[model samples]
Target: MQPVVVPEPDGSVRVAGRRVPRGELPSVVASADAGARWTWDDTNRWYPALLAAGVRVERAHDLRLAHRILRRSALASWPEPDAPPGPWDTLPPTPLTAARDEPAMLFPAPGPGDDALEPDPVAELAVQDAVVAGSAAPGRLRLLLAAESAGALAAVEMFHAGLPWLADVHDAVLTEILGPRPRPGERPARLDELAHRIRAALDAPASLNPDSPRDLLRAIERAGVGARSLRKWELERLDHPVIEPLLEYKSLYRLLTANGWAWLDAWVRDGRFRSEYVVGGVVTGRWASSGGGALQLPKSVRRAVVADPGWTFVVADAAQLEPRVLAAMAGDEVMAAAGRGPDGRGADMYAGIVASGAVPTRELAKVGMLGAMYGGTTGSSGQVLPRLAKAFPRSLAFVDEAARAGERGEIVTTHLGRSSPLPGATWHEAQSGAYQDDAGDDDVAKARSYARSWGRFTRNFVVQGTAAEWALCWLASIRRRLWALGVSSSALDAGAVPAPFAGRPHLVFFVHDEIVVHTPADLADAVAAEVEAAAAEAGRLLFGDFPVQFPLSVAVARTYADAK
Candidate 1:
């Protein structure tokens, strides 16, 4: 393939030769070698406009995202020993088109994350490619980058396509749960009644607000209750007439504030809720929503997610994803065999553990495995831990080593080489103070407590992060398969979806280990098949020859809430 450069901010700057007009970008990208991988500073900045302009690429390397991975990855071999780690370490690289010395993208200042053009992105790409190629595990890292880049593309597409939403249904659900919509500056009727009951039972003044935690705590104290806070668990322990009403009030209040009428007005537009998803937002590689709370659609509001006439939603969720992932990554034959089961169904891996006679019961097996992964050291989970250890020692040892490494302030990496974050300077200072000559027992205890707290985080990181990678693979596979499946044969689309996504089965929503596809009714079964096929493909793509499998509970329905 020949290299052709067009340097007019249309993502052809990497080749560094000539300029191309904005209107000509589609033709230029189209004429270039079909297999050429476009190198860009950031996919979010450049790709969106191109996609809006109806241009898509087969392959591309996002330099900023790739650089962030390769530089710190334990699997990569950095050729530049003395290179400064500044600027690139920060999250969300600054936009290329932003003005100098001004607020640009993610961060509001002109430092670290704000400087998008240091060390030359082109040169950085070369170094990263070299390092990854020379790494001990190049294939895993390479697949990770590919999967990550594909995720970036998928995120943009999802944002553009948007999730089909019905404002009327959302309003109906909110009204059913919250009573009539209150007037401006007024509380809902149900919440108001609960607040009154809470104050009356506590013998507080009629004007006392149950929403204010401090005021409610004072009221509880005045009522001869031992509660110091209005937290749910703390309130549950208290035996008071106001406790039940207060808990109910808090629950209704949260739902009203989070996804009530105002949310519908702001988020729902043209029958879609277009959430801007942040790719790799979490440290564990999970996607986070910028607006609309797309990732956390509670069951109360899920009923609002209804497909258009003659269209349906294909919902699928991975079963016991983390444990299945652990089974494959650790290469533990016992756990892998259990994960695969007789029919390659990963249905409740903990149940499989019990059937294998690793533990006495399913509940014990469940908590024991959770304890092993999450560093639980007391209660029912801790009691069953020993039995689980002897049964699946390899998988048990994997997380145990990670936890120990974290306790020593050492960074542990995921299966795909994303390293756990280092403890902050304040954390290090606390640890240092504990080690000093004048340090007391409390200081050391506090330090150890903090270390163990972080240890729990790192211990869960490997499994969760690798599970995230598998999800990316799954999504990418589903996207490809649906694209290959083409439009449904009935040749009708009632959804009235936007261009590019119209007449197509498109991904509408995704949470951890679960996804929903909005498809024409005729293609609903096809989408479900693709979703299940993608899960199996994801398992194979990540584990290769491993016996472990990832299974999905799938449903094709007209509404999101009906899937479960």
Candidate 2:
């Protein structure tokens, strides 16, 4: 492997004794050794250009992402830079935009005080290397950084490939559900009808708009309906003439605003829907969508995600991911055994819990497990917690310890060392006020409630954060396998599909534990096998030889909705 080469601000690259001119970096990268890994300030800044120029790098070290991990990781002792916070310290991930036709340099030429703001990728990489080397768990920390950087690359590639979408299908679905797109500021025909019904039921005047929450609430109260909020669950329990129409109005309104005709026009282009995927956008290390609501695609709109003529989508969703991760993290073999079937393959862990007599039914087992991980200590969850704890003491104790630590205002680290943020000053002040000499009962009660809430946040943080790490590993592994598979396959015609991913099975969509890979129809089965293999590999990467299983529900379909 060659040493990491840093690109200068003027688009020049300096090798041993040679200088590559501006605008020639792409070709240089394309011809570099396959094993050589590129170290850049941000993958979003550099990879897009390389991909546009028909160039692809096998590996990369994203300094910005690595710095974020080391800055907060409890396992690493990050050395603060000598100068004040630079751009690398505060730089946001560049969002992928539909209109970006050219690549922008990450670090521009400095002028006056701008020198301090300029990021030095070589220095940043050195610092990250040193931090990881000196960390308490160097191996795991290294793996975490690698997976995170790989995820960044995959994110850029997915955005570049875009998700296969049919605008006609989307328009048709919207028209059927909302009764055609509304003109300019007017409501759809169906929404207008539902609004009128709601108004008549509430005995309100025609001027009342059902979209306004305050106005709707006031009208509901005036009509003698016992409703405090417009929430679906809350309204569902009430018996009133207005409840039915009001609920229906709210449901369709959400669909119209979130993924309606306007959204379709702005997001979907050509034959695909391109979304900006923010890696590590969530503190839990989960990805977030900056635009396009890619993470929250409603079921009504999912039917519009259609594959190309000769291609199909291989959708794989991990089953019981967080619980399985918890079982492995706690080294609870008993809990892990529940996820194994008679054939030694992965099975439903909740059913196994029921069979073990931990709970009377599978639903109770699921609720109890969710309660244990999420700090739900009331109602059905509360009722089954004791039995679950008795059955899986180790797993239950693991999250219990995290929750207690949170209540005490201590930071809890995930399995791979992504630590939770510390309690704020406001939280500390509340806790202190409760213990004051003249403190009243209200103060104590308020502090206790605040503590419990923070406890819940931390209780789920560890499990969710670790699950995200597992997901990153899963995506990274699948990405490499897909590239290799595509390179080795001969049946694919590179011209039939989009550039860069013309002949390959490429990842198009990912949310939490699920992923959709667009591939040739003939290779759909192979892609499904690889997706399943990646889950098991992610498990081993995180837990080593732990007997926990990370099973996937794999499906091959032409549309995203049918796969589900």
Candidate 3:
């Protein structure tokens, strides 16, 4: 029950603040003395500090958070091992550069007794705390959406700044917003509108010459103002006259690139629009796009994406993918087995992990196992995983290995060949030196650490990035298949495919880990099957061996929520 401490070679002991058996002390201490730092927990900001110290420390696979707390609290006074335990050191540190400071706890002070009060003072205190928290960062409520919006806005701002030609377009778009549509045959309604706006802006009559490149540029500039400030997600913004045309162009550009004019010609014949998606496009593995609004679909437009008469959409996903991957990686056999089906068989890989009683939730199963592997130091995985491991030793071993490697400053990699490199020599001297020493907090050392972290990032990138490639291939494959089917039929065949997604599925919508193909309802199920088969085929094509099993859950539905 006592805290773990390993004496470092430099005289100062690198304490784990975790439980250590007497027999293990000498080796652990020896490792610690060799400049090995304890990986307190996964969230420790001190990782860079450890790397800087020239410590080759590895995280203890079995350290718990509670034990870490006990150690930190005990070590809070430094060099003294008898101090009372504290909770702060067990948890991760708040980075100095973070936008907001941690909130303080609010509790009712000893006031009049609440036994006879109309309302409890404690409840009022809670409300005050909530308000304070909200006020501290009201934008946090929409931070995720806002982050994406910010990226798009940045792109637009950058484009506008770099492309002076766009100003004329913007001016034209503004003029069009205030002008009326023109009669057919005189000029297409869209061009006519643009002409009216350009004329008004110049204070004279002018018309858009469809054949002139300069005139086309003017027309585009006029039509683009609607989307200039896309952060306004309100319904009113959607109704703006300039908005639709700009979106249409953007969408058209994407379609044309993805399929070429040939595919677009065919899509027009069948009344179905296809969209392609890019998964794991964001650091968080959320979907993004090279082109098109793959993440954004208005319901009004969505309704128009019905499947052709005979097709149905078969949509599916791997249930609890990350959780299952964690369980498998952690070596939790019981959890892994629980991922099976009924009759004591593997049901869903994730659900089985839950059934194995390793953790109540799939996320916990993964996070907890990771916590354990990373020297959770203070019983961080809680009581669940340890107990589950009692019944599933095989499964837990993988996590133990990762933890050991991490503790040893060894980079762990995925199934692919991607490997992370060790930190440069500069980081070592800084840790051995004083906090104020020239070596300490050296910008070069800090920058090196950042680069080292990016190297570690590449370790995961191989697996996730390869997966993204497979998804893209699968999409392209199914898209081609669909096109071929349409071409063979008399009902569909015509126009040039759009860009970006040319020769690929018109990826109408995508979120991280999922895609929605806008195919005819009649062929939706068939397309879904094609997608599933292509995904599996993609795995084989890339890895040669299955490596890990790749399975997907598919569904047919009329609404996005239906997939859920």
Best model per TM-score:
2
lDDT values, one for every candidate: 0.78, 0.86, 0.38
Model 1 has an lDDT value of 0.78
- In angstroms, the error of model 2 at 485 is 0.7
List the candidates ranked by TM-score, beginning with the highest. 2, 1, 3
Q: Each prediction's TM-score against the native?
A: 0.91, 0.96, 0.38
Give the range of the ten consecutive residues with the poorest summed lDDT in model 2: 101-110
Please list all clashing residue pairs in model 2, or write none if there are none. none
**lDDT, model 2:** 0.86
**Candidate 1 at residue 422, lDDT?**
84
Which candidate do you rate higher for lDDT, 2 or 3?
Answer: 2
Tens digits of per-residue lDDT, candidate 2, 1-564, equal 534555554546554335776356677777778888788777887777677777777788888898888888889987763457667779887656722443444222334565456577777778888999999999999889889989999998888889999899999998999898778999999999999999899889999999889998899889989988987889999998888888888988999999998899998877889889999999989999899999999999999999887788999999999999999999999999998866669899899888777888999999999999999999999999999999999999999999999999988998988989888888898899999999999999889988988899899999999999999999999998888786425546654356678877889999999999989888888899999989989999999999999999999999999998
Q: In model 3, which runs have C-alpha deviations exceeding 4 angstroms?
A: 1-314, 323-336, 343-346, 360-383, 388-412, 420-512, 538-549
Better of 1 and 2 by TM-score: 2
